[model samples]
Target chain A: MKFKIAILGTGNVAWHLAPALEEAGHTITEVYGRSEKNIKGITQKLYTAESKTDLDFTESIAEIFIIAVSDDAISEISDEIILPEDSILLHTSGSVSIEALGYSSATYTGIFYPLQSFSKDREISFGEVPFLLESEDQTTLQKLKKLAKSLSHLQYVVKSKDRKALHVAAVFASNFSNHMIRLSEEIMARQGLDFEMLKPLIIETLSKSLELGAKKAQTGPAKREDLNTLEAHHQFLNYNEQIAEIYRLISQDIIDSI
Target chain B: MKFKIAILGTGNVAWHLAPALEEAGHTITEVYGRSEKNIKGITQKLYTAESKTDLDFTESIAEIFIIAVSDDAISEISDEIILPEDSILLHTSGSVSIEALGYSSATYTGIFYPLQSFSKDREISFGEVPFLLESEDQTTLQKLKKLAKSLSHLQYVVKSKDRKALHVAAVFASNFSNHMIRLSEEIMARQGLDFEMLKPLIIETLSKSLELGAKKAQTGPAKREDLNTLEAHHQFLNYNEQIAEIYRLISQDIIDSI
Candidate 1:
C-alpha cells in the first residue's frame, strides 16, 4: 500500500507531505521545485529522495505524482509536467477540481486533499489530519484509500462540489477567526493593554464552543442583544470606520442568525 | 490575608467565584440569591457558607461583599444591599464603572471583573483567568490585590475608561470568533459534512494565532486577494443573503486591512 511519490512544488504542503509520507513508510522518489534552495529544504528531510529543479518528471519512477501547488497553478503545472506511464496524478487542493489534472498524461487522475492548514515551520500531527480523496477510476480510488489510510485514520471520499463548501467553511473557521483575534489585538493596543490579557479568553472561547457547540456557547452583548453595550462599543470603534464597520456587520449577523 | 467574603449573585460568575475563593483559603460567609435552588447550587461547594434567599445582609459578618449581578442590576442591588461597616463592596462587571456603587454605604468600593466567560456546568481553571481590578481608595486596591493574588497571578489595575476597551475587545475575541465558527458549522451542515471534520482545523487556527500573533497567522483567499477563489465562494453562499453579506464584508475588510 506504500506509494513511491514525486511531490511537485516546494511550498508548505509539499514540505510537510514529503516527510510525512516518508514517515508513514512511503518512499519519496523525488522532490521538484523551481528553486534549488526550496527543493533542498525538503529533500534534506527524506532518506533518499532525489531533488529535481525542472518540470521534466519523465525520469521519475514514482507511481504517484502529487502537485502540491497553489489553486491557480494546478492546471499550468499539471499541463507541463511529463510523468511516467501509468503513474497516478494527484493535486492536493481543496478548491480546485479533480478535472484540473485532465491535461496530464498519467493513466489515473485523482485528488488527495488534506483538510488542514500547513506551515513549513510548524509541526503537524499527521494522524489527526483528515484526508479527502477522489479519483477518476475505482482502482485508483481504492489505491488512494490505502495510501491515505497509511497516513491517517481520518479520511473521506468527497466529490469536488462538496469539497468547495468545506474549503470556504475552512476560510471562515481559520482565517476569519484569526482575523478576529487580530482585531482584538488592535483594540487592546489602542488602550495600551497587553495582548496577553486576551489569550486566556481566546483559548477558553474555542474550548467552550467546541465542547458545548458554538450556538450554545455563544455570549456577549451581540448574542444577548444588549443595545447599550453594543452602542457603547460602536462609539469606541467609530474613530476607525473599517473596524467599526466590521463590528457592526458581524454583530448584526449574529443577531439576525439568532 | 484570607478574607471572609459575601457573594450577592448566584449566576455563572458567582457560581465559579464562590468555589474558587474557597479553594484559595477565603471563607464565603454568606451567598444571597432570589432563588433558593440557585443559592444551594453554589453554597454546596463551600465549607461554611450560609445561603440567603433574601437580600438583607444586616446580620452578615463578611469583610468583602461582591455584587456579581448583571450590568443593569448592579446599581439597583448595590443601593439596596445592607453591608457591615468597613466592608469592601465590589461589583464583578467589566463594562460597569466603579462609580456605579456610589449609592452603597460600604467603606470601600471597587470592581473585581474576571475576564472570562463562565458556564454554570463547566469547570474553569481559576489560575489562568485574569482578574481586572479597580478601587475607589488605595487601601481597598491593596486589599483587592491580596484577594486576587490568592486566586490568580494574572491581575491588572485597569481604570474604567481602558477597561471598557478590554471588555469590547473580549467581545471581538471570544463571542465574534465563536460566531465565525457557527457560520462554518452552518456552511458544513448545508453540504452534509459533519462538524467533527472542522475540529482539527479550528484547534490549529487558535494555536497558530496565539503563537504567531493573529496578524502573522492569517491566510486565505481574502488575505491573498485571490479573486477566483473568492468569486467561487461568493457564488456558493449567494443563496443566503445574510451569510453572503457577512462573507462579503469580512472578506473586503480583510483585503482592506492588509
Candidate 2:
C-alpha cells in the first residue's frame, strides 16, 4: 500500500501533506522547494526524504510526483516534472484541471486535491480532511484512490471543474467567515469594546448554525426587523463607509432572506 | 437575603432567568405574560409563583419586578409595573438602558442583561453566560449585583451607551456570522453540494480565528490576493447580486485591512 512520494512546493499544503503521507506509511523520497532552509524541518522528521531547490528529475524516481504548488505555478512546475513511462503525476490545486498536469510528459496523471485549507504552522489531522481525486482512466484512478485512502477516509472522485464550484462554496464557509471575525474585531476596537468575551459566542454561533441548519439558526435585529437597534448600529459605523455599507447590505440581505 | 421576584415576559431570556433565579434560592413570587397557556411549565417548576395576564399591583408586592420583555416593550411594561416605596425594578435588556425602567413607580431601578442569545427550547447554563448589570444608584446596583452573582460569576457593570456598543458587537459576532453560514449554505446549494461536509471547516475556522486572533488567523484568496480564484468565484456568483456583492465587498475589506 506504500508508494514513494515527491512533493513539489513547500507551502502550507505541502508542509501538512508531506508529513501525513509519511505517517500513513508512504515514502517521501524527495521534496522540491524554492528554499532549502524552509524544508529542513520537514526533511529531518521524514524518513529518507531529501530537499531540493529545483525540479531537475530527468527520470521519475518516486512512484508518484505531487505538485502541491500555487494555482498559477501548477502548470509551470507540472511541465518541469519528468515522470517515467508508467509513473503518475498530480497537482493539489483545486481550480486547475488535471490537464494542467497532463501537458507534462508523465504517462499517468491525476489529482490528490485535499478539500481543506492548511496553515503551515498549524497541525491538521489529514485523516479527517477530504481528498478529491481525478484521473484519465479507471486503472489510474484506482491507483490514486489506494494512495488517497491510506491518508484520508474522506475521498471523492471530483474533477477540476466541480472542485471549482466547491472551492467557491468554501470561500464563503471558511474564508469570508474568518473575514467576518476580522470585521467583528475591528468594529469592537472602535468602541473600546473587548473582543475576547465574544469568543464563546462566536464558537457557539457557528456550531449551532451547523447543527440546527443555518437558515433556522439565523438571529439578529435584521432577522427580527428591529429597526431601532439596526439604525443605532448604522449610525455607529457611519464614519467608515466600507463598514457601514457592509452592515447595510448584510442586514438588508438577512431581512430579505426572511 | 433572597428577594421575592416577578418576571414579566415568557420569552427565551425570561424562561431561562426565572428557573435560574428560583434555583439560586430567590423566591419567584409571580410570572406575568400575555397568555396563561405559554407559561405553564415555568410556573409549575417555580414555587408559589402565580401566573397572571395583567401587571396590576395595588399594594406592596414582590420586592423586585423584572421586566424581561422586548426592548420596545420594556418602557411600557416598566410604566405599568407598580411596586412598594423602596421596591427594586430591573429590565433584562442589552440595548435598553436602566433609565427605561426609571419611569416606573418602583423606587430602585436597574438592569440585569445576560450577554447571551437564548432559544426557548435550548437549555443554556446560566452560570457560564456573562451577565451585565447597571443601576441608577450604588445601593440598587449592589442589590442587582448580588442577584447577578447568584446566577453567574461573569458579571460586568456596564452603562447604557457602552452596552449599546456591546449589543452591536454581539450582532456581528453571533448574528452576522450565522448569516455568513446561510450565505455559504445558499451558494453551496446551487451546485448540489452537501453543507454537512462543511461543518468541520466552519467549526475549526472560527475556533482558530478566536484562538490565533482573527486578523492573524485569516486565510484564503481574499487574504492571499489570489486574483484568479477570487475572480472565478466572483463570476460563479454573478447572477446573484447579493452574494456577489458580499463577496466583493468583504474581499476588498480584507485586502484593505492588509
Candidate 3:
C-alpha cells in the first residue's frame, strides 16, 4: 500500500506536505526545487530517496507526481516534467483548473488540492484538513480518492468546477480573515492597546460561526445598525484614514447586504 | 459576600450580566428600563426584584448600581436617576468616559465594562470574559474589581482612555472578523460553492492564531505578492464588482503594510 510520490516544489505546501506524506507511510521517491540551498536543506533532513534542482524529472520512479508549485509555475512545471504516460499527475492549486494538465503526456491528470492555508514553520495536521480530489477518469479519481483518504480523514471527490469554487472560497475564508486580524492588530497598535487582548473575542467569534451559522451569529454596529457606536468608532479612527475608510466601506456593505 | 445590586437598563448587557451576577450569589434588588415590557420580563425572571419603567428609579435599590444602557443614554440615564449618596454607580460601557456616571447622585462611580459582545439569544459565560474595571476613586475601583473578580476569571483595571482603545480593538477582532467571514460566504456563494466547506479553514485560521501571532501566521497571495494568483482571482471576481473592489483594497493594504 506504500505508493511512491514525488514533490516538485519547495514552497510552504511542499515543506509541510512532504513530511506529512512520509510520516503517513508513503515513499517520497524524489524531491525537486529551483533553489540549490533550499533543495539541499530539505533533502538533507527529509530526502532519504532523491533530491535535485535540475529538470530531469522522470515518471518511472514514482506512481504519483505532485506539482506543488506556485499557481504561475504549475502549468509550466507540469508541461516540462517528464512523467510516464500511465502515471497520475496532480497539482495542489485551489484556483487553477484541472484541465491545465491536459497538455501533459500523462494519461491521468487531476487536482489534489488541500483546503487549508499552509505556513512553513507551523506544523499543520494533514488529517484535519479536507482534501478535494478530482479526475477526468473514474479509475484515476478512485485511486486519488483512496490515497487522499489514507492521508486525511476528510476527502471529497468534487467536480473540477466545484474544486475551482472551493479554491476561491478558501481565499475568502483563510486569506481575507487573516487580513482582518492584521487590520485589528494595526488598529490596536495605533491606539496603544495590546492586540493580545482581542484573542478571546476572536476565538469566541469563530466558535460562534461553528455553533450558529455566520448569518445568524453576526453582531456589532454594522449588524445592529447602531449608528451611534459606528460614528464613535469612525471618529476614533481619525488618525488612520485608510483603516477608517475600510471600516466605513465594509460596514456599509454588510448593512446593505443584510 | 452577597452584595446588593441594582441593574439600570434591560438591554443586552443587563440581560446577560444580571443573571450572571445572580448566579454568582449577588442579590439584584431592582431592574430598571424605559420599556414596560423589558421591566416586566426582568421582574418576572427575578420575582423578588422590583421592576419599574417610570422616572422614579432610585427607591429601594441596592448599594451597587450597574448602568447597562447605551453609550448615548449613559449620561442621560445617570442624570435622571437618583441614588443613595454612598451607592456605587457603574456604567457597563467600553467607550463612554467614567465622568458620565459622575452626574448620578451616588458619590461612588465607576465602570464595569465586560470585554465581550453579547446578543439577546446567546448565553455567554461571564467567567470567560475579561471585565475591564475603572473608577474615579480608589475605594470604588477596588469594590468594582472585587465584583468583577466574583463574576469572571480575568479582570483588568483599564483606564477610560485605554478602555476606548480596547473597544476599537474589539471592533477589529470581533466585528471586522465577522464581516470577513460574511464576505467569504458571499464569495463562495457567487462561485457556486457551499459556504460550509470553508468552516474547517475558518476554525483552523483562528486556532492557529492562538499559537502563532497573526503577523507570523499570515499567508496567501497578499503575503507572497503572487501577482499571477492575484490577477486570476481578480479576473474571477469580474461579476461581483463590490467584493472585487474590497478584495483588491484589502490585498493591497496587506501587501503595502508587509
Candidate 4:
C-alpha cells in the first residue's frame, strides 16, 4: 500500500529522507521548511510534493507527518502543526523524547530516528542502516514499524531513553571518528604526507572492528601499554600543544581503562 | 615465479606474514625467532620449514629474509642476522627508517611495511591492505614489488621519510579512530546504553570517509559550532571529569579547526 507522507524540515535529514521515502513507493504529499528557498530545493528534488515554508499542516491529508528538524525545533513545529485525530506524527531526532508529540492533536506520535550521519552530497543506502522506531500506542508503533521496514532491513523498537543513548553513541561513532581521521590528516600534513595514504589502514581498522567487537579488537601503543612509542608520538606532536594534549589524555584514558 | 623467503621474528608480524607468504606460493626455507615456543607455533602452522630461535641464519638460503619485529628490535635483529651476499632483507616497521637496516650484513636491504594492525585472533587478508615498500637498490626494489604484488592489490614504493608520514597517519586512521570508538563506548556506559548500538554508525562513518574524504564528510556539534548542545553535553559529563575534559578539548579543537 502506498502511504502519503509530508516532511516538516529541509535540513540534512530531510534532504536525504524525502528522496528515499519517495523511492520506496510513498507519496510525499507536502514538504515544509523554514525558508522558501529551502522548500524550493526539496520540492524540486522531490517533484511530487507541495512545498510550504510555514507550518500549516492539516489533519487526515497525509497518513504520516515526519518532522526532520533540529532537536530544538521538533517540539515547536509539532505544537504549531494542527493534525487530524487519525493521523500519525513522527520526528527524526535521536535525542528528543517521543512524548514531545503526545501533546499534539495527532492520534499517534513517535520517533523515526535513522542511526547515521547525513551529508548533502553523500548518498547513503537506507537499506543497510538500522532505523529506531518508538510509539506510546500500538497502532502508531505498527505504522512506524511498517514505514521503517519499507526503507531499511534493520529496525529496532526502542524507548526514548534508549534512543537518546543510541544518539550519544552515534555522535561518538560517527562524529568523533571523523574528527580522528581529520586529526590524522593534520598529523600527516606536519610530516609532509598525503591523507590518501592512510585510507587503506582506515578501511581495515573499521572492518576489523566489525569482525571483532571494539573491546577485543583494540590495538596500538595505548592498548599494549607501549610507553616508549607513546612518549615518542607525544614528543612528535609537541610542536602542536593541543594535539599533544589530546594524545596524552586519550592515551591515559585507554591505559587507565585497560 | 616462486620466490624463496626466510622469516625473521615470530611475533604478531611474523605470525601473519609467514602464512600470507606461504599462501602466495612462496617457499619459506627458514623461520627465526628468539624463543622455541614462538617458533613452535609457526612450525606447526606451516610444515616444511627449518626453525631457529638463535640469531644464526643460513648463508644464501633464500632470495629474501623478512625481518618482522618490533620497531626497537628491527635494527638489533638485522645486525645479528648474517645473510648471503647480494641477498635482500626487509623489516616491517612503519616508523623505523629503511636506513636502519643498512648496517646489516645483507648487501641489499629494504622495508616491506604492511599498513595494517595485526592481532593473533584476527585473521587479516593481505590482499586488501596497501604494502608500503622502500629500497635503495633497483634489483631489490623489483623483487619487493613482485612479492608485494603477489600478496596485495595496492602497493606504494614510498621513501623512508614518506613511510614515517604514513605511519603517523595510520596511527590517526587506525589507533585514534579506535580510541574514538572506545570513548563512545565509555560515554554510552555512563548513559546506561550498550556500545553495540553505535556499531552501525561507526561502520557508516568509516564507509563515508572512504567515499568522501574525511574533510568533506566531517559533521557533529563541533562542526556546526552548536555551543548550546556542547555546553549541555559538557554538563552531562560532570560526574566523569576525565571524559568531560576530553569531550571539551576535542570539541573545542574541532570548532577551532572549522
Q: Estimate TM-scores for all models.
A: 0.98, 0.96, 0.92, 0.90
Highest-lDDT candidate:
1
Each prediction's whole-model lDDT (CA): 0.90, 0.82, 0.79, 0.81
Runs of candidate 1 exceeding 4 Å displacement: none
Candidate 2 residue lDDT tens string, A115-197 = 77678777888778778889977888998889889987787887677778877778788877787787778767877877766
Winning model by TM-score: 1
Q: Assess each model's interface with DockQ, reporting 2 decimals per model.
A: 0.85, 0.72, 0.61, 0.60
lDDT for each residue of candidate 3 in A39-95, tens digit (9 for 90 to 100): 665566564758777755653578888999888788898788777657889999887
Which digits, one per residue and each the tens of the lDDT, describe model 1 over residues B184-211?
9999998999888889988987899999
Query: For residues B170-250, could you state the per-residue lDDT of candidate 3 as single tens digits?
Result: 776777777778777776676666676677777777777667767777777888898877877787777878778777877
lDDT of 2 at B209: 85
- Write model 4 residue lDDT over B124-174, tens digit each, in one string: 889887888899899888888899999999888889877766665677678
User: Tens digits of per-residue lDDT for model 4 on A62-159?
Assistant: 88999999888888888888876588889998778987886777778889999887878777889877888898889888888889999998888889
Clashing pairs in 1: none
Candidate RMSDs in order: 1.3, 1.7, 2.5, 2.8
Off by over 4 Å in 2: B58-61
Interface quality of candidate 2 as DockQ:
0.72
Of 3 and 4, the candidate ahead on TM-score is 3
Binned by DockQ into CAPRI classes (incorrect, acceptable, medium, high), candidate 4 is medium
Off by over 4 Å in 3: A35-48, A159-161, B34-48, B55-58
